[model samples]
Target: MDPWLSMYDFTYHLAQEIAEKIHERNRYLRNGENPVKINLSVRTLLKRLEESIGQLRDSLLRSVSTRQITQLEGDRRQTLIDELLTKERQLQMSFKGDGTEPDVIRSSLMSGGGAGPSPYNPWVLEEPEETRGLGIGDLKQQQQRMIREQDAGLDALSNIIARQKQMGYDIGNELDEHNEIIDDLTNLVENTDTKVRNQTRHVKLVDKKSGSCAMMVVIVLLLIAIVVVAVWPSN
Candidate 1:
């Protein structure tokens, strides 16, 4: 098999796989099943698909670099690339919402009602209600509901932040009060230490004066005793 043909087939099958996965996801949503599993599976599949597309693009570039494709083959390869791009667009539209209705409605709204379906997009002519399995009105309603949910989430987050801010302020005030109390206690301790030192000095001075007075009293008593002995010398 030609390398280009092999690459084309790979891309074509990968696109089909993505489309089928989209359908599966839609079915899960319709059934009101837990979307977590489906979402995880879809995400994994999409990653693989993107990697495969990159590989395909690189392979085409390598062929061109090697001058492997004839002029006719080059044109065919270009057509294949176009088809892959279309499929990729379709896959993206499917992921955005209930298939392509959102994109179609958006384009129509943007064009101011002057836009018609293009010949290249045959799927665009198909009734969106049928293809997407939902009316445009329903799609709009879903979008509005999603917006309301998002608004509610934002409000909740804002409330939480406000509460946290208030708590932070309260904590800061408490810390400041504690610091002030610590400073006051420190000053009180220093004043007490100074008073204690002054009292110790005063006590030591009083003790020295008492000792000097005792020595003077002893000297006076000795002089009186000597005088009495001299006056009684006749005995």
Candidate 2:
């Protein structure tokens, strides 16, 4: 396979995975459930997806600028990138409804997270007995600070689910269009092949008939010579 095509396939698979994670995350958010696990997964996957895309883009740029890439290959890769980016943006906008995703992230971070609530897990914050005495106002202030800090890393995770939904739709649409074209070409090739086979058979049949006629004519000429000799004066 072409390097560009290989890169495209990897990027596309990552994008698809990210999109699915986002959808699952969205459902979690809507239900006011904890999206910490999903969010973390998405973050991990999203990082990989971004890296894959980055590599793919670099390859595409190099190949395309050198005119080594076909227009179709370029279009397929470029279209996927465009669709992924657009879907990301669309999710950011549409998923803005309840805005629960951010709140859940903030809560998870304050509670502590990562690998089942360890000291460094961003999703789980331990509220011990001593801290329980702190006034509500002070606690709010602290939580707000934590939210801000976590949001720094969480900036992209927010509304990611919405984007995945749109991304899936867009990607599917683009693929469908290309698939239809491919189907048409495949059908055309099949039809042409059938015609060629039929013509080949016809040519073979005609050759066989012509050979038989020639053999019959040869036999007839031999017989006529014999008959002429028999009917002519002995000489």
Candidate 3:
């Protein structure tokens, strides 16, 4: 309901998607699938995350313009911003990886070692025949370049994955602390209610006893007046 909460949720989901894409790429690698496709998919996801970051910034601006935020809310928003920035930085790092991947793919092609044409995409165009004339030395050079770029991309992705894992653990810890606080508040409310009910009962018993004492005193005064009247001589 709160705008700050909404932004937090948005950021969380975006981070989750990024993490999933990374894991998906890893799976594709393990399965001996086309690395080019995996690279493309990851690049697309990074672009989407970039767009989402822009939207999140705009959303925060709108929220601030529409209402005055309290100190607590401001702190929360700052925390969310910090988290989003962290993710954004990771996305930028991944972007660095994406930037190198094309070079990696092209070099792989020049070295005659890329994954073959996709069977699922019959409409894809083939490379020019000019690439066939490249000498062995040139091919070796491209292969070396490809290896270097691939290594760089892998390092960036590994860092992003590790950071995402740490963020997840931090979120888990915050949730646990919130749950404990909720439990403590619940116990406090229950104890207060019990004490209130006991006080109410005690007040009612005291009122009843006071009423009985007053009635007994009134009865005794009436009897004393009656006895004095019966014992006195007529004037």
For residues 1-235, write the lDDT of model 2, one tens digit per residue.
9776777677666655655566567556544577888778777876676677677777778877888878887888787676555444333332343433443533333333233523443222233554343554666677788899999758667668679989999999999999999999999999999999999999999999999999999999999999998999975
Ranking by lDDT: 1, 2, 3
The CA lDDT at 28 in model 3 is 43
Clashes of each: 0, 11, 0
Task: Name the top TM-score candidate.
Answer: 1
Q: Name the weakest run of 10 consecutive residues (lDDT summed) in model 1.
A: 118-127
Model 1 ranges off by over 4 Å = 1-6, 9-132, 231-233
Alpha-carbon shift of residue 48 in model 3 (angstroms): 53
TM-score of each: 0.49, 0.36, 0.43
- Candidate order by TM-score, decreasing, is 1, 3, 2
For candidate 2, give the lDDT of residue 163: 92
Q: Write the per-residue lDDT of candidate 1 for residues 139-179, one digit (tens) a residue.
A: 66777888999999999999999999999999999999999
Q: What is candidate 3's lDDT per residue for 59-94, written digit by digit as tens?
A: 667766776666576667766676566655654454
In Å, residue 32's CA in model 1 sits off its true spot by: 29
Model 3, TM vs. native: 0.43
